[model samples]
Every structure is written in structure tokens, then in C-alpha cells.
Target chain A: MTAHATPDDVKKLAALARLTVSEEELPAFVAEFEAILGYVGQLETLDIAAGSDILPYANTFRTEGTPHEKGVWTPDIVKAFPNREGDALSVKQIIAND
Target chain B: MESNLASLTITEAARKLRAKECTVRELWGACHAAAKTDAVHAYLEVFDADDAAIDAAQARIDAEGENASVLCGIPLAIKDNILIKGKVASAASEMLEHYEATYDATAIKKLRNAGALFLGRTNMDEFALGGSTENSAFGPTTNPHDTDRVAGGTSGGSAAAVAAHTAIASLGSDTGGSVRNPASYCGVVGFKPTYGSISRSGLIAAASSFDQIGPITKTVADAKALFDVLRGTDVLDSSTAPEGSYPEFTHEVKTIGVPRSLLEQGLDPYVVQAFNTALEATGCKIVDIEIPSNKPALAAYYIINFAEVSTNLSRLDGIRYGHAARGETLLDDYLLSRTEGFGKETKRRILLGTFVLSAGYIDAYYRKAVAARSALIREFDEAFKTVDVIATPTMPTPAFKIGEKSDPLSLYLEDVFTVTANLTGMPAISVPMGTVDREGTKLPIGIQFTAPRGADERVFTIAAAVTGEQLY
Candidate 1:
């Protein structure tokens, strides 16, 4: 497939990434990403093995029990946020609920 | 009389310290002075000679003597992402600028126990996200060889610190090509050990599966020395294999691997010339290389990296322990804190990661990336069956201007030659082959070597033989 990724496409990717992109920077990002993506597009033609040999489940242990992935965080630890002054984090509102 | 301790390698300094040729305080002051004058280093902070602190650290080691790790009393630099109690571990991101660490990273604890003084934190890409130090919120680090070009980064400050003699050696986390890339640009040796070879207890998350603390130093011997101390499992980092000592790590080899396919990529002519010269000079046989879907490794890497980062960084909402989340609702704080605290590139990654991992797109993008990654690794396994190691240009080109490409993808491509090793969980290093760009302003090009999963020792030994020196 001889397909080219457009600036709008790249911008959409950037926005999904949550990066703050000025309108002025869009053309530059598009051109540059297009160059790289175009080059990398060659990957579409190659054949790759289908499955992984890696073990996805890592070893984990807890004081109370042994688990596959240890040290999972709990919401109680989530209470440790410094920015949270009350039940929620406090900051200048980014948008108004019109 | 050479008063600059910065000009000396830790190996040399350790010998001097052992011989009583230089006192710890004297060495510390020399290091302190060196750190201050080396402007290109871009160290996030520097410590005053803590005579008492140095004395205290050295006293225990002195009391322990020969049993102590060799890095004792040596002052060193730490990349910002590694934790050091009371100091901030910012990764040069503004969000964590005010955040202080509550404990030492496991490796830092070991180094401290060995009597190494902390010189302060070095600069890096925001959250270790970009290639050039230009992505640093603090500012880009300049290559000491020629300030005009970049000191290839996210670990630029660490490499620059070693190059400018700001620290005898420095600690950096390599995810993709951070350590080796900068080390090559600065004419130093960068070693990224076998995955899980070293602990990552306190490294701020940057593609967790791939990140590992590596060393950057003037010589391979110095890097080897630091590596000796830094290697081994930490209970704190469960990913590591049980602690095992290296007895035959430095044994030399007569055969080296050179991938014609990898080397023939569109490299700068000078880099191409230098790479071939170094390989030919080694007087060793070159073995062929292979990896399936080899071309896809770079693209797969970025996709996987973005997916991992977005998931990992979702925790940094202004509410919890990072920059405050300031939105009326929980989601608002998460969005604003992430948008504000993260640099442009970091945010771009998080969004891409988030999108790729999102429900509708997960299988098409994220899962596809992982599948491609497995294919690449299998290819590496197959190639190792025929060769002891694989060699390629550490980077596609020499150091580019700091901001020549605003496109994030171009920056990601900088890791192309280096990322495959990261993906396969293999050990690799970059040694300065020679200069490529014009002199005075000449930029250093690097040649990389990779060995099998458990064969990090072989890679180092082979690198030592080919380079014909300690890679200073």
C-alpha cells in the first residue's frame, strides 16, 4: 500500500499523545513525522515470526501471599498525593463547564 | 603539576587514593572545581567537598579495606531519574523539579556504601523522552569535543560530565540508546548491560521493560570498574536474576561479529569509513548477522515505548506525588498536570501511547507492536546461533544540530541502530570509532556491538579487543 500519512493524521496522533502543539508547529511535525514514518513504512513488506517466547507473567511476592506480579499499588497508597488538598487534587481549573 | 582531578579516570584516582598519593579531600576538591568549570556538562547540581561526608564514607571502607568495592571515595554523577534521598530525581522535567527523593536508588546505596561521593544530578530529556539534550527543560548539553553539536542524549549530561571531567564517572539509565548514544558522541565508552543484569530500583519509569542503569566513562576499564560495582541483583528490583559475580567477564575473544546488512545502511560516509576501519583493524573474523522483521524494530520500539509510557505516566496526575493536578475533577487534574509538567515531546508520547493502548486501537497498534517485537528478538536469537556478536553504526548519522528536526519521529529514529538490542534484552556498547564531521568541530561516530542474552561479558571483551584500548 503506497500510503502517505498527512499532517492532520500526525496532528491527531500528537493530540492523542496529550502533547501541547501550537497550530504553527503542525506543518513542521507533519513533514518530519512523514519523513520518518515514510521510511519506517518499509516494515509493512517484511515477514515476522508470529508468537513470543517470553513469559509475560513475572514473579511477585507479598508479605501475605506470593503473586505473579508483586507490589501492586492500592488506592490507599493513592491517598499519598501531595497536590490533593481534599477528596480531590486542587488546581486552577483548565476549562469551564459551559 | 596537573591539578585537575577531572582529567583523571576513576581507575587512576582509585590507585592514587590507595597509594596515599592524593588525599580524599584533595581529590574531592579537584572534582568539585572541575564540575564548576566544565560548563558544557550541564550537571543539575554540584556538591561542596563534604570532607566530613567523604571521611565518613571512606572511613567505613578504609576500616573494611581490600574487601571494599574499588569505587570507594570516588565522586560521581547521577542522571536525574535515579533516586538519591533528599535530592530531586527530575529527569529534567519541570513537573518533578520540586520533588525530593525519599530514599536512595538501590545502586546509589551500593555506590555510597563503596564510599563514592555524590557530586549531584545530571540533566536529561524530560522523563528521558528525547534523543538530543535539546529536549531538556533545563537546556541542551553541549559536546565537550565541540559545543556546536549536541552531546547525543537523553543521557547527555551524564556523558558530558564524564567528557568535561565533571565526574570521574556517571550513572545513566539506558532505554533505547540513551547511554551509548551520548557516550559515543562524547568519545567515551557506554555500556548497557544484559537486561536485568543491573537493578532498576529507583529509576524513574521510562519504558520499564527496557530501562537499566548503565555507566559512561572515559575508558572501558573505568566503565568496567563501575560496572563491577553496579552489577548484581537487588532485592528491591525483582526483575534481576539472583546476584552472580563475574569472574571471566574480561576474557578476550579472537572472533567479532560484523553485520554487513546493518552497517550498509545510509550512514554518513565518514562514519561508514571509520566503522570499517575499526572493524578491519581488529584483525578478527567477521560473522554474518540476521534478525527477522529487522526494519520493523525501530517502528515497533516507538509504538511499544509510547504504549508503556502512557500507561506508566497516567499516575502523574496533578493529584498524586508529582506536579499538582489542578482541575475541578480528578480527570482535569490528571490532564492539566500531565500537559503542564511534561515537555512537548513527553506529552506527545503519552498521547500516542494512550491512543495506541486505547480500547479500539489496542490490538491494531499496541498488540501488533508487541508481536513485531517478539519476531525481532527471535531473529536475534537465530543470528546468535552463527555469530558471537553483531556490530553496526551506533547511530545512523553523527551529532545533528540541537533543533534541526522538530518532528518527534526523527528523534525516535536516532535510536534505530541502538534500540534493537534494547528490544532483545541484550547487552551492547558504543565506542568512539573516529571523527566524521570537520575537525576542531569534528563529531565522533560510534560503532556498536551486541551479544547474546547472557553474553554481556563477551560483548565487553570483544569490544575491548576491537577497540584495542580501554576506549578512553
Candidate 2:
């Protein structure tokens, strides 16, 4: 594991997280990240021999229920959309032009 | 006139309403007036009294008489994260600044059925990420007692409203002491019930496994009354525990455990003294106990918190709802919207979460945190075999001056004592212990009591005993 997060590492992580950390904020972000990492790094010393049983999964099933009436929430949902085109949400194009 | 009405506890207010000493509108008026002059800035919006809800509550009280729920006609402040259909539930973040809830949170629905009045949504750390409300996209909620001091948070506004008498009680979600920290700092009672005891449906997601909608109120009984109404299984939230999900806690608290080793350092003298006094007043046997994994519990808690936050917040991609920004490319839209939408602390946590959960680092960080969490839970389970409950100073010190803990690590350290309950999914409550003096001002601190999972009633009983309040 890396000992500390550098400014570059923070910038990369920001990009991955879909956040944009400005160049000016990178140093401070890196410093805070390193501090937090150091703090949580205490867990690295903990022996997990008795604790490795972490994923305790249980299947919970629910009875089928009638769905909400169509269009009941559509207006509110569509209204909250930042950009709407008629009845549908509008977004920037994702397909590449041939 | 309204101030006196505002100051009455929920039980007292209910009794008075029953006796026809005050009208429902009058209580609302009192609280509204308090909110109007509130220097604490607890509420993001102090809604104009819901005339219909007030009328309905009064009609219920008039018809049911003594059979009315104690919360009937009570004015309650809601944390911004809990949805109230047709009302804004921003989680105090800019991303959802104008986002109105399309449906009521399960807790809000329960409270509405009981005829509780919604005063307004209170401020919090944006998306409930920080220990202090200063991280709010709006502004920080100052301690009601001392305007210069911070009301500890992510639930700072909820606690502040209750403490400031702007609301009879409030609901705040606790992931890691979000409710109790503010309650402790503001000198009120904050309770985090067993993780699944209260349905999480409609409450905005933070750390799903750790989050529980809890009550911040003037007294422990008020908290219990609210909790009783809010806790139950829900079809929408599969994580909610069914009735009898865990073994019942039948006996009164007989033995209380003190993790004295953890308390040996970093506690204010006032907090140390108040905790001891509160425990002694309970008249329960106190014994030293050790949970070795607790040493690394905060670290584990934050790791899990970051991971969950990153996952939960991904839903806000600026496509369907909430804040959106235009960018040349689709990927840039997500980045631009998020960067402009979230505050610094939120972005920091998101990055940390991404790092921990990233492919190369997942095993080193995420897996380790999960394992450590399991060990901590097991350790707590072992401790409960011998003790009826555990006690600690809710905060290491009284409310610090606003901006005192600018360093994120220092702020995170304030949560060291409270994160254990969230991590282990145990029930915990912070009752006003007493106050400590700083700069000639008295600041409140709290004594926290934690019980085994599903032993929620046990903590209330002990807390009532300590606070000298009647359990009823």
C-alpha cells in the first residue's frame, strides 16, 4: 500500500469519483487524505484471523405486490429532472459519430 | 408567552393539550416564534404551520382524549435528509438544494399518523458527512447555549432546534453519532436505535448499514415515545428488523461496563467527572471491560463510511434529478455537476471512498475495514455477555468554539467514543450529563449509554434513571 496520497493521486481519485478537485485545492486535499489514511492505518495492525468472517449474507424475500399506478410519480420525477425533453429526460449524447 | 410554550417537554405539552391548557395552534405559534428569532440558525426552513395537520391533530386529541399518542400535536423538526413528500429534503447539500421529496420517509409517515406537526427541515453537514454542521452547504448551526460555539453535527440542526426550544423534538439520522454528537454538544438527549430497529426507507442513504433514524429531544422518555412509533419492519426497506428480530431485554440494567482503558486519555476533566457521576446515580454495578478491537474501530468506521458514501451518492449523476451542469461530454457532465454541486468535505470523502474501494486498494483498505468491523462487533457481543450496558462520555469535551476544530482529523477524533455503536449496530443514547465551563460560559456535555442490539429499552431505562426522568 502507498504510504501517503500525493497531489497527483488525489487528482486521479477525484476523477474516478466524478469529482473535480481544482489544482489549488489538490495540496490541501492530499494532506487531509494522508492524515485520514494515517488515522485509519491503525487498522492495518489488527489481526483479522478471528474476524475474517465479514460477509454474512442472508436472503430476504418479499411477497409480490401491486406496482404503483403508472404516471403517478412520473410528473414529479420528470419535473425534478434538470433538463427535460417533452416527457423524457434530456441528456448529452453518449454515442460517438461514425 | 410563546417562549414558555416552546420550553415545555413533549410529555408536559401533551398533558397540557389534553387538559385544554393550550391549543395546538398556540404550540405551533410558540415554536414558530422561537424559530423566527433563532440565533442558532437551526432550521433551513421553518415551515408555515401545516394548518391541516394541526387541525387533524387537535381533532384527534379532542376525539381520543387520553388515548391520543403523546406525540399528537407535537411540533417536530426533521433533519433535512428525511423525506417529507412535497417538501424539500436537501440533506443540507447544494446538489439537492431545491429537490422536493416525492414521498414521505417511513419515519415521517409514522409521525404524521401519530399527528405530529412538521416544524421544518433542520440544517446538517452536507449529506451527513461531518461531525460539525460547519460542513453544511448552507451554514453552520451554532450551539444554542453559546452562539460562539458549534453545535456538533451532521445532525446539528436537529439537536439545536430541540435545545433552542424551536421544536418539541426532532428526528436526526445517526450513522456515526450524527444525532448523539449534536445532542451531546447541545445538551439534549439523542438516541441511535439498533440499526434495523427503525425503517430506513425514505431517509437519504449515507452508510446504509450504519445509518439509523433517531430522535433528538428534551428528555429520554420523549425519545422513547418517538422511537416506539418509528421502529418496525417495512416492505420498502428490507434491512428493517422484524418484531422479535433479537432476543428481548427484560431485566433492568444491573451492571454497566466502562471501557476505562479507552477513557484513560484525551478526556476533559469535566466530562470525566460528569460521566462518573451519571453512572453512580444509576446505582448499577460498574466494572471495567475491554474491547481490544475498539482501538481501531474509528478507523474501520470511517473506511466503511467512505466506501458507503461513494456508493450511495453515485445516484446523483445530474441526469435525472437534483443539481445538473452542462459540459461538452457526457463524462464531463457527471464531473462538473458533482464538483460544483458538492462541498469540499463531501468531495474529500468521495475521493477517499473511491481510493479505498478501487481495484488495487480494496483488499488493503475496504476488506481490512470490514474484517476489523466484524471483530469489533464480536468483541462487543462478548462484552455484552457480562454487562447489561456500557457507559462513556458522549464527547471528550464540551462544545468547542465555532471553527475550533478546522483540522478534519481533530473533528474526526471527536467521534471516537460514539462510532462504536454505529459500527456494531448496537443501541446507544446520549443524555445530558451536565455542563463544563469555558470562557465564563457553561457548555453542555452528555453521558452515553450503549446496550446490546435490540436492548433499546434497556438504555432508555438506564438513561431515565441517570437523568432522573420517569420512563413513562
Candidate 3:
């Protein structure tokens, strides 16, 4: 797995992570991925059981209850948005025109 | 006068404040003045002492006398990752560099209620990703002992501030050695309480399960003082343990476990010698113990770190808040913002995280790491049955020269000893053992004591014994 990581694999990983790696930086990143993956790959040698639990505890869900007031934080939250109009946050359109 | 005042421990400062020997304004003035001459770049921002907060603390002391909280009027530094309402909680990253925290972190609220003064927000690894704060967007925090060397990080600034006497104490969030690593490098005391002992509601997440807010102070007693104020359950962070979630160790620490195999290689000769000296000084029976899982602990820890960091940081997509970049498409927006906002180390972790959790590879990497985690925890549990505490060199080597470790894996390997406590959700402390010379300069090293989960007090008890300090 360490030697197998290529520039293309890193490009795909960067895309999956929503990060951009420039052409000049791809080789260095791929090299780093190989080195890191090789190091972490040592875990493959461990004789873990077939059905060990990942976490010590089960998933925890907060009890269903009354939510905080709707507009109490709206103004403050809206103030942090990068692009906003009135109280609504704006983003680049995702839908294609027919 | 200011330097001497700045050097006072939290307990000493509190005593002075109570005796009316120094006003809250004077204490803040001493710390603020020291912070202004910070050659190590320990602070991201040294806040102007809030007049109301000062007057309020002074008033409390004047009105309540000895009844006032011991922390009242004591100046402390906060890691940038922890939120303080209306202050910039950047986590030392450009993405959220300008973002102001809308609400106070649970820890901040507790400290405020205790009347602790906020001297500043300290620098750290960007998003707490790197072991050395060289990854900080603002700049690296150099060690106070040696400016050419790094203050071990991602809590580097917090530790450096205390070591330099810029603040009496500071809070640092440790996931894998973040607090203790820096404390070891800077020659101060750092403690990571039992995983859920401290709430994470206001802390910027690095890895969900591993992160625990801890204290960095001049003495073990000071660390204990801050921990007492910070530890507890919080409604906002459900991960916080309820009262008696872990059984208390009622017996005295009579034996210490040494994982001799793990220390046979890679540690500095001086560090090993210092550790041996510190262990003997504990006056506890020493016994050899083997937890083979310790070898793969770093690998497992990093796998989980990448996976969680990738998932946790996904919230910063540039739509609602944080650094934004214009792009033709929505996807393009995310890529551009993240690319421009994050440092190389941060992007590297996020990519590694995505790789491990991606389809087809999840079982091979992420799942395997998870099982390995369980195995490691079980091994620690088994080891603890025979020993009350485990002793090790807090770091493999003392603070390395700045730019010394250019490779990322090298830095990850430095966390070999400290990550085990986080992996097992146990409490650990690093006490300054002694100094080891690096060339003409004498660099400080630390000896770490790890106790069973919920045995946080035991770690402090043993640490105080090793350092010959009275526990608070």
C-alpha cells in the first residue's frame, strides 16, 4: 500500500477531501502519502480479533427535548457567513439550468 | 517587580491577591508587560485586560476576602483552539483566522466564573495538526529555553508562555501529547486528565475521542489547581463523563510499571538516564511490564487522527463562515477555500484521512486501526492490574532545533510515548525531570506518569512525589 500510492491517487484523495493540490505540489504530496501510509501500515501486523469494537462505548444521542430559541443566535450566526443577504447565507448555485 | 510577579505560581499569586499585597490590575499588568516582550512568539493576541473583568475580580476579593475563588485575579493564557466569546479562536489557521467565537467554551465559562484573568490566546499548530507549532499559520513558537529550538506543540505557545513567565499558567488541549510534549520541551508541568474528565464543547476539534483540555503550569500543584477548576461534566459536550463514571483508586501508588522494551531504542541517552533518576526518586517499587501494542500505538493514533480531523474540519466549507474564495462552481468554492486556507501539513492529514475512510479502503485502514485501538486499550488495562502507574520519557528527545524535523513521519514518531494515554482514555502527567545538555545549552526533559483511567488524582500524586512538590 505504501509503494502503491501514486500522484493520481493523491489527486483523487485531494478531490475527495475538497482540497486542491497544484501540479507542482503533487509529487511532494504523493511522496509524503507513501511515507505516512507505509508507517501507519504497521498496524496491519497486529493480530486483532475478527469482531472487535471500534469505540469502547455505544453511540450516544442527546435526549429529544426543546430546542434553543430560533432567532436568538440567528443574527450573530448570520454575521459570520462569508456571503449573506439579510439573514440568509448565499452559496454558489448547484443546480444546472434546463 | 513585574518579572518577579510574573514568575509567581498560581497558588502564590492567589495568596498575594487575597492578602491585598497586589491588586488584580497589578497582576494583569505584570503578565501583560511580559507578554509584550514575547521573543518566542507565544501569543497570537495579548488581549487588553478587560477593565470590567479586573474590577469584578478585585471587587470579589475586596468583598468576599478569602472566600473568593483562588483563581480570581490570576492571569492565565488560553490556547487559540479553545473558544472565548467574541475573541478570535483561530486554532492558528488562516481559514478561521478572522472568525470570532460566538459563544464561550465550557472551560472558559468555568474559568471566568472562578475569576481567572485572560492574558491572551496562545499560538498552536494550525488546527492542532502538527507536533511542532511550525505549522502555525501565524508563525512558530520557539522554546523559551532555546530560541533556535521549537517549543514542542501543537500546544507549543501555551507551554512557552508559562515557561517564559509571560503567564502564571495556561490551558492546552492534548489529543496525542499536544500539551505534555510542549511542556516537556519548555520545562514546565503538563497534565492530560482522564479523557472525559474535561468537556470539549468549546474546544476546536482535532480528533473527537482523543482530545482532552489540560493544564500547563510552573509546578504540579499549579497544574492540579487549574485542572480542578476545568474538570467536570458539561451539558454542551455529551462525551464528558458523569460523576463516578470511572472508579476511583483508593489505594496509594505503591508500584510503577516500566515498558522497558519500548525504551530500549530511539530515546536520547540523557532522557533515559533522567527517566531512571526520576523513577527512582518516586520511591515506588519498580517493575517491568510489556504492552506489545505500544509499538503500533503511534500508527493507530495517527490513523484515527487523520480520519477524525478530515471529518471534523469538513464543517469549514466556506459557505456559512471562515475563509472564503470565489469559484465558478460550488465544489470549486470548497476546494479553493480549503486549499488557500490550510497549511501543507493540514492538507496532508485531511488527504490521508480521506484515503483511510474512503470506500474500498475503510476496512483495510480505518477499521483495522479501530480494532488495534481496542487491543491497545485492553493491553493497558491488563498492565494496570499489576502496576499503579507507568513511567516513561515524556518525549524521545528534548526540543529539537527549529526546522530540524522536516519530515512529517519523524514528528509523528516523537509522540510514541504520549499517545498511549489518549488511546486508552487514561490520565497522564509530565513533570520536569532534569536538564540534558544539547551542545553548550542545557535543554529540559520530562518524565511522564500514566495512571489507569479515572485515576487522574493518582497521576498527580505520583508526579508531585517525583518532583518533590506538595500537591494542592
The lDDT leader among the candidates is 3
Candidate 2: where are CA atoms >4 Å away? A55-59
lDDT string, candidate 2, B109-155, tens digits: 99999999998899999999999899999999999899998999999
Judged by lDDT relative to the true structure, which candidate is superior, 1 or 2?
2
Taking all chains together, the TM-score of candidate 1 against the true structure is 0.88
TM-scores, all candidates, are: 0.88, 0.98, 0.98
What's the CA error at residue B458 for candidate 3, in Å? 0.4
TM-score, chain A only, candidate 3, equals 0.81
lDDT of 1 by residue, B1-472 (tens): 2357667888788877777777677778888878887679569888666677788756755576666567888889899999987787888988888777777888898898778888879988888888878888888898888787788888999998998887889998899999999988888889998888788898898898888899998777777888888887667777775544323344445566665666566767788888778888777777665554667788788878888888777667665576875556655655577778887777667756765676765655566667788887777777766676788888888788767866676677678789988888888988878887665577778889888766777767767765676542
Regarding DockQ, does 2 or 3 come out ahead?
3
> Which residue pairs in model 2 clash with each other?
none
The whole-model lDDT of each prediction reads 0.76, 0.90, 0.91
Q: Chain B alone, TM-score of each model?
A: 0.94, 0.99, 0.99
